[model samples]
Target: MPNDSPYKAALQKLFRTRLVARLDDLRQALKRQSRTTILHALRAVGYLTSYSHAGRYYTLERIPQFDPKGLWRYRQIGFSSRGTLRATLIHLVETSPAGQTHTELQDLLHLRVHDTLRLLVRARELQRKPFQDTYVYLSAKPKPASRQWAERQKLAPPPAPKERNLARVIDILVDLLHHPEDDARAVCQRLRAGGHPVTRAQIETIWAHYHLKKTPHVRSRHGRL
Candidate 1:
């Protein structure tokens, strides 16, 4: 089609009004029954097919205001400067300082990417490794993957202290003995009121250790539940 073609003008007008158009919409606006002609017109004007919605949507390349991640969304339909969803995921993982996790990707893309991530790993286009309880997606290259892993380690929260004070445990146990109906919070309040300085976490730990339940039943002097 020529630059002065009426079909291209009509397509541009449609895009100006709707911002995004489906292939059918483009065909209708161009007044052409041929998919090839409509697509040719779109290409001539520089168009982007959405990475989302199974590429059902299209917009002019100049229309999107891409974010720092090279992503743009129009009414939940996503467009990526990197092109398809697979390419976008690879780019994001390769560039991330600490890599990206399933949750992180899902949160950012607002789409479930479990299958895509699995496929990328299987194809060796991306790498995945265990991080905390979830897997982190990394660059396929070893050096970058190692750097991302190390950066991820630095970002991890410090481990919780494993050992509880014996005195604090005893204080919590004694308080539970007096008020069997009290839950961990109630026990902590009572112990703190009496200057025991026990935290609810410590009280809960003792309760868990003793297999104790806070119910209406009272404990006998022998300490049997």
Candidate 2:
């Protein structure tokens, strides 16, 4: 194949045919006086790639082969997948069934989309709702977002049972006082085994009410965390 390197022989004449480089590497190779000045100059020449992780890695446009969706990455840095991060994010959220979270989006795209998502939300191009201690992204339209919220809630686990009665509450406290070292499940086992009506769920509530320290639970292989 014909040499497709952008700099071709020019790169060899300078940095030995290395077409892509970080700001410092390029500056050293070119014997440039200023890194900041050179970076801006490179951007003007259309050689800057998108920053990823914590705003570090950089490469040239040709170093990445952008997929149809306008995305690609090398090592830690990535290239823009399409138009703008904001646009790509909107496209993903629009087509998603369960929407997406900040971490989820980062994991999938290999780039941080938090700032773009914020901009999109403010512009009403997307919607966000609280779900399980975190916000889930959703469609901007009311109907789709509403449906997603409903589905998100429907899929959530049921709340723990409550011990509203005073006598039941006393029984729970008494058990805890007698078995100070017992974990929630252990207390429930003893209570139920002795014919009490209390459940592990109710025991958990008592734990929360008094700000009691919970025993460290060892998760079993069967997913018993």
Top candidate, metric TM-score? 1
For model 2, residues 1-225, the per-residue Cα lDDT tens digits are 223243333334443355345656665654556766555555544564454544344555545677765677666556565535676687777666667788878886886677878888999999898888878999999988887777767666645335466677777789878877788888888888888887787788767666677656567889856
Q: Which candidate is the best by lDDT?
A: 1
In candidate 2, clashing pairs total 2
Candidate lDDT scores, in order, read 0.84, 0.67
For model 1, give the 10-residue run with minimal summed lDDT. 156-165
**Residue-by-residue lDDT tens digits, candidate 1, 58-102:** 999889999999999989999999888999999999999999999
Residue pairs whose backbone atoms clash in candidate 1: none
Identify the runs in model 2 with alpha carbons over 4 angstroms from their true place.
1-48, 51-71, 109-113, 163-195, 198-225
